[model samples]
Target chain A: MVDSGRAPRRGRPPVSDEQRGRQRLDISRHAVRLFAEQGVAATSGEQIARAAGVSERTLWRCFPTKESCVEPLLTKMLDAFRTVLHAWPPGVGLIEHLRTAYQPVLDSSSGEDVEAVLAVVRMTHDEPALRAAYLVLRERAEETFTEVLAERMGMPPATFEVRVQAATMNAVLKVAADEFARETVGRGITPEVLKDHREQLAHALGLVTRRLSGTDVG
Target chain B: MVDSGRAPRRGRPPVSDEQRGRQRLDISRHAVRLFAEQGVAATSGEQIARAAGVSERTLWRCFPTKESCVEPLLTKMLDAFRTVLHAWPPGVGLIEHLRTAYQPVLDSSSGEDVEAVLAVVRMTHDEPALRAAYLVLRERAEETFTEVLAERMGMPPATFEVRVQAATMNAVLKVAADEFARETVGRGITPEVLKDHREQLAHALGLVTRRLSGTDVG
Candidate 1:
């Protein structure tokens, strides 16, 4: 029963999914750095590939378009937010829970990561292509928020109230990000700046969700 | 010394901006009809032009792309919303003002116009290109809302609170429109349905903007 070629393992193991993700993240970091240094219009996939030490083919395989190179970082930020939101303690106000849980993540992120994320956010304010990518990612993330909020409130995901709640929460977060980006124009993200960012977010979230409770949103 | 072709002396009066807008709106209605009859993918620009009783060149001039043919209708909807919001009476609660001032517009809209608008909104739920166009129009409209809300709240347009308020307001309206579209599936918009739509919008707006006041958002 010689099935070596048909069903047996190859000599070299395939790259793990985690390894591929890491490679994509690394490429995204390089692409973002180039975009920040130059501009999105002037940056090219070939330049990003060269900077990331990957072939152009590999870079294309990782991203469908040049503008999408920022998706990895944007998705990472959203994933962190979703993680914090999903782990929110029951019976505690969402604003208070977010203040306690989400603030530390912002405080503890590597300065370089924060800078890159902020730079991408700020660039989105002016770059239409980058703004499109950021918005697409945000819209996709909002679907998950709809599901989570619906479950928390014992309502269907398609209910208008649940849908709007999710949309409003994301809208508040997006505006807060834009504000943070604006604040970082000349000044970098310092402890004081980050704290201000956190408080601004909390204040906005409090205003938005003050009426969203399990029993009485409508 | 007449400049002849370079100067005045046009035989026929130029198409007024209002006439051009009417032409675009007419072309858009035809395009939407074709899209509703056939899927967006199956509908062609030439087909839309034929249905619209115009040259393909005219249709192309009217819309940058086939997907954007829906923009005129979406923009009209946003413009109407802005008109209502701008005319909202002061010293009255927003929800109450919207109910008194905005609900009549919805109730009085011609049935055909409401049907076409609902069809386009419902189609956006399935078509990504149309959704992009819809989102682009909404984002542009939000900028004006930002200005209006900031002025009403006595804050800078770029302030985080005002920006988020504008965004949340648009998000609520968008979700309410989506709900209205969903309700129209297999049935037409009725008085009761439209009333429910108005209440849902007011409720969602109340939830998002309960704390947005002239002096105390922060």
Candidate 2:
């Protein structure tokens, strides 16, 4: 809604925050594709810039390091997560909220965006630098989970119990993300079968965290 | 004991496993310090090689990426955990084994080594590149935990229950490491009291994973 095609009346033909974010995401998407096609070490900032149709200096402006070219794409994977957490209703349970949010997030996301995200995450397993970028994002996501869980559980984020919950919850989500990524990383699963994997994730989360309820039979 | 000093008269210089492990640890220790002192972005392979007193080519031989230069030092932090797991006798609980293993691990680790590890981990909070490396190490640690938990729980490593245990257990450890690293990263903690932090880790592990017992009041 914020995109204005016209040249702005403001000084320096200003770039909006939304525009800047999109630009960076575009550049990162290109970088990830290049890194995946060849290899991260073999791919240079100049090549990424050329593929993205931007100046190398502009690429550096958006990303300080070459290894960080995947950060924006990694952040994309977590966009649904953060949004879901932020909008989580106070009365609803965590599992219920996750199940509710899953399909909508998938529906809203373009196939290409999800494809790029999974591609980048898959590369993290093989590429140390990209993996590092991916992990940094994971750590940030855990921090967000801690805050959200703390608020929901009526405890400080730093409380020992809360942190464990946050960590374990994130771990379950990670396992799901891993499964989804694995499907794409290999021969690529069809959307219909992929939906079954989503259900698998929901089931896994319930099983893993059911100990919290004391309801699951060992 | 296997660190023999005798030079090999064969095709390549014979380095004992212990000796090679130590050599890699030494190089990685130096690299982490360099990363800590200067940002990872600013640090160069040549600078790290000079600091470690190795040729640039030798540094490349030891580590494929500049980001991976810290891997050996990280592996050192987990060495105690792995060794303790390997020696975990049957009929012993997981918590009990950890408590028994904690002190000896700390005692065997050199002050300099621990300092380097904490330094890098702390940097992870602020440095994206280093954070990635730390996360990569954390992932491998999870795999190892999965194997150990599989044996202890009498299940396959890939079992859902086994993985949840592995992930949760690693999360607890990460909290302890985070606390310990926090102390070292800032004002540094006393070694005697630092010993207490190890116990805190043991206690936290018990509390976090106790739910696995099917007995939580919550």
Segments in model 2 whose C-alpha atoms lie over 4 Å from true places: A1-10, A104-108, A184-192, A207-218, B1-10, B33-44, B104-108, B184-196, B207-218
Candidates in order have lDDT scores of 0.81, 0.74
Where in model 1 is the C-alpha error above 4 Å? A1-16, A43-65, A104-109, A212-218, B1-16, B41-65, B104-110, B212-218
In terms of lDDT, model 1 sits at 0.81
Q: Relative to the unseen true structure, what is the C-alpha lDDT of residue A69 in candidate 1, on a scale of 0 to 100? A: 92
Local lDDT at B63 for model 2: 83
DockQ of 2: 0.42
Q: Compose the digit string of candidate 2's lDDT tens values, residues A99-175.
A: 66766236437777778778777777787677666766777788888897777767899987677677777776777
Candidate 1 structure quality by residue, lDDT tens digits, B1-218: 87767765658878899999889888988889889999898999999999989999989988877978987776777777788888866666778777767763364355676678789988887886677667766788899999988888878997788888898998888888888788878887677887887888888888778755323433
Task: Please list the Cα RMSD from the true structure of every candidate, rounded to 1 decimal place.
Answer: 5.6, 5.9
Q: What's the DockQ for every one of the candidates?
A: 0.57, 0.42
Q: Model 1 chain B, poorest ten-residue lDDT window?
A: B209-218
